[model samples]
Target chain A: MKRLKYILMTLCFSAAGLLQAQESMKSLMDERRENREANYAKWGPTSEHDGMGFIVRAGYVIGGTSPLPLPAEIRKINEFSPKGGFSLGIDGYKYFNMRWGLSAGLRFFMQGMHTGANVKNYGMSIVMGEDIVSGNFTGTDITETRMSGFTIPVMATYRVGARWTFNLGPYFSYWIYRDFDGHVFDGYLREGSPVGQKITISADNPAFYDFSDDMRSCSWGMEFCADFRVREHLNVFGLLDWGLSDVFKDDFQTVTFPMYPIYATLGVAYYY
Target chain B: MRKIFFGLSLAAILGLVSCIQDEPLNAECDIEQAVVVTDDAEAWLLNASEAVQDVPSADTTIVFYLREEFMDENYEGWDRLKDVAINFRLTPGATITPENGSAHDFTQGGVYYHVTSEDGAWQRNYHVMFIPVQPLTVTYDFENFRWESLERYCEWFEYSDQGNEINMWATANPGFAISKSSATPEEFPTIPWENESISGHSVKLETRDTGLFGVMMNMRIAAGNLFIGTFDVANALQDAMAATRFGLPFNKKPLRFEGYYKFKPGEKFQNRTGVIQEGWVDDPDLYAVLYENTDENGQSFTLQGDNVLTHPNIVALARVTDRVHDFDNWTHFDIPFEYYKEIDEERLKTYGYNLSVVFTSSIEGGAFCGAVGSTLLVDEVKVTCEDEDE
Candidate 1:
């Protein structure tokens, strides 16, 4: 848990450095670009609306999960280690003008989170198949999950001050695989309600569960991306795919949190 | 491109609110442990570990074995126990009757324990029975054996004290064996079959290590043992009343306790907390105690580890301290009853006196300290009633 905290902290501080570098790099290229401005009358297909092309990109994704309804104090989230996933996509775009455009694309990505927590005093009612995990907890708990799928996203794109670019879109996904599993250790479980007798969860008295097939197979969500061109045909990008649907099937409620996958990624792309 | 990506991200956020699923439930079904802490040494021992407690329930049954001679009608407890100060160690998400350890009036029926599964779909209803104290029988040959499907072994049950009829004996083997053992009589540790017995199979007790997990819970050692009353595991960690207890209601002043036994002591000498003694030797224990079954206020009391050997209420005692410690052959040994207080003849009819013939592989096993390889085998045990014809 402490390691995860430190990693996230590092990410927060490094973000600003990357942004500053990108801006400085953009400015350094601006003066040179002005000296070599393309002819407006005959810029060929490289200028604005005159262009129609495809771009392929691959990226590294970081996902975030929030276990809601369970107040922070109750679910004293102790450890969080988000496995970095990957995304690859191809998109075709047409510019209406130099600054505005529309794009549609197919993207494949894997997103999820691994976390350790403790349910101290807050009570939650969870259902895992024919079982119920309902009650407050003070024991160590861990949950690891993942969803791999493809998304069809329709994005609006904009070019800002030369080659700096941004895109945002809504997408629909059809997932091929998912896994949800966890363990509760050295704790007592009140089988039924708050007033239930306790079952010990320790080395001698242990418990583990799986909720893989019970997850949702299809969902809808949104994606956003920002890119800076390093060359005429190559661009480095950062993207965030925010899931709007719960990973679990409609009837499944084993996890008390309304968990949505917020995947963030950075990659390089080739425009052709 | 930036404008297009930003616009799509806003649109995805719109559906985020509607995608929330239902919540999960807590799945646990167990009665962790229970204890009694009333500060009445003459009546109730404060330590649950000294008594028979923490009895693991069958998936469907919650068993709370009581060890006293008579229950206080208002058994929420006396003095300390009534203040609702005692707590139950349950699963993280579990709740119990007498909500929050409040004073519960168990004078009528049972305490109910409901366990909800993790997925909110299923739950179990456990009927927790705190069997009140009653008189037990004498003269045990250790013959009755029945196979209960749950344990997949020959198991014996505690006889009811209410009806004054009993054909069974009790033991600390339940706590000693440690695991969810499903072995028959000829198995390891507790139920080892006795081949050299003069009669049917005798009881063979061997000391054991309950394992690392048991040690983590402070239950490191399990001494081979058999006794006359309850050994409730739920209250095993509290006071002697909750864990180690050894007397049942009896009327007459017994003359002697005679039994055939074989012995072998394990090499190591240690205490319940796992502290090893450098030069101490382990020895098996056997004794018969006749003590007052009622306190000064006429309240019921059962002899427990705290006061069994030294209590002022004791009327007679028969103990074996100089037995042949390493004998393998079945040997006959007898201890004559020594009287402390005069037997009150009228009190005998009122069931105010009790007798306990207890045996264990290690004398200090109750404190979680004992030798690991020690074994005690016994058969043909008989308690001489005070009848003149005998």
Candidate 2:
């Protein structure tokens, strides 16, 4: 009976200690929140990202360079043709109601795509960078392109049941890398095209067309995304980055067709 | 978690539904406009006393008809010459041969003009022939031809006629394949696929898929073709009406087009949208057009893909009816011309008409449709006259 009594007392002591430690941790956490609130009240926010959110994404960017207001044909996204890319950024949110909030973030999109096609006398114009000229081409030929950029998005978000979240907004992007490269061996280009002859354009011929500058410095588009909370501080998400602005400059008529960048991002987020 | 899952699913559906395929850019270079300058009081072309055809088309060709009175005594004792200094007005940044503004020696009958496109990537040659209007019936047997090479770029074959070499026979061969294969004309576009006693050598025209470039532009196939007139690169992307000239200036009222041909259409048909039309059988095109070569302004009219067969200027035309032909044997075709109006023999003998004989492995290839493997082998192409009967 004495031994039993000793065990019970020891268990009670341990429980007390655990409770005390929990109280201390809670206090510390509350103090930190208070400090954050105080700082927010005292100084203005400096970042466009939501005042308290972050996301890290690793997913394929599924899209192609196309004319604006994409056509039905482009709408049929080839699920297999998506390219590898990534997204990482922080955001700030302002909740107005139980289910209504606004958020903005500064993010970088490292996305790219490479697709192959067999067109018959594809009648179109090709334009390269500054050293430029537009030319028509027909016959069989092959081409590939890659692109990446930095983006800023402003979104309207809705939260449901404390575990579900949805966001829709417009995104602005500035490209850091751009390329439209390939070969024209099987067809003929009209005289006066930047690449004057029926020619092969590979890395070997640095003289090949580089359309990097032909891309617009700034682009804007609409997007929609959703997030599912996995833990108090962690969530998994998927997003769409739909561009509204043309990918080329206004005067750059070579790529006469209006094209925009529309892509998707699937990833995870750690938020405060 | 269930609500979150539902929301995510809804978003995914929206994303996919809102997505679309991008429209392709224009990647062609074609002559948008062409004109001839002169050294008369206003220094103009088409201003000669008897000049008829004047304004130029996007084909980079400028035709000027003279009254046979302007034949220069210095250059041609056999005929009078148009003593006007001729220049050119073409797409900005474009250049001309015989040096724009230089006096042309029309005494030799036909003066050749070469227009170098603004980008210096394409060139179109024109034959400015000044001859007394007469019956013209021509035949091509794929003989007496020579291939000219542009080093690693391209090569083309020329026809020898009228005591001179004619650059009239043009194929998209050099323009399409040379850049990638870096091949010469001897092996690239024409291989003289076969030789038959009736004609000697049959010209084989084959289509090819442009390797990497084809993928980028969505223009996958390059159909084999043989036709009269020049291929203007400038209009290829911007205007379908100006893309391919289906006819050339001719003064003859032809009654028939006789030729031996072998054909096999490609298995797939690819439209401008890049969709493969499965089970779509491609057909070879064998047709000709005879139209008023000059307009009221005395400007020469050249039929392009848009209006070739349907132009109001058409006076007569013909086309082969057989689409299915034996591959192992040459199929003889004799298509008679159908007249829309009575032949004005006198007017026809006065440079009043133009004709075109176009052959393609794919009938809709010019509009960006056809299978890649389509083939057309032709030999002993002849155009007979109806002088006595008509």
True contacts kept of each: 0.00, 0.12
Model 1, A1-272: lDDT tens digits are: 99999999999889988999999999979855653345321221245446677889887666555543345434455666667578888989877765677889988888777877666434544443332445555467788887788888899987764567789989888888788877666565443344443445564434455778778888877878787776777887778777788877777656666667776767789986
lDDT, candidates in the order shown: 0.63, 0.60
Residue B58 shift from truth in candidate 1, angstroms:
4.9
Please write out the lDDT profile of model 1 over residues B1-390, one tens digit for every residue.
434544544344323323444433444544556554444433444112223345354334443335454355565443333232334555556555445455654434555656554445545566544444444555666765555343533454434435433523556654433332332444445563557676887878778766543444466677777777656543443332346666766766688888888888888887767878888888888888888876887666777766678888889988887867756577788878888888899778555676777888877777667888888888777778687354
Interface RMSD after interface superposition, model 2: 10.8
Q: Could you tell me which 10 consecutive residues in candidate 2 chain B have the lowest summed lDDT?
A: B41-50
TM-score of each: 0.49, 0.51
DockQ of each: 0.04, 0.08
Q: Please give the distance, in angstroms, between residue B305's alpha carbon in candidate 1 and its true position after superposition.
A: 5.1
lDDT: worst 10-residue window of model 2 chain A: A198-207
Candidate 2 displacement at residue A253 in angstroms: 23
Each candidate's interface RMSD (Å, one decimal) is 9.9, 10.8
lDDT by residue for model 2 (A1-272), tens: 99999999999999999999999999999998677655433332223333444455444354555445434323233232445477777777776644577888888776655544433223355532212323444443334566777788899987654566789988888877776654444344434442343332222221234456677778888978787777766777777787778777887666546766767676777766
Number of the predicted model whose DockQ against the real structure is largest: 2
Model 1, residue B71: displacement in angstroms? 21
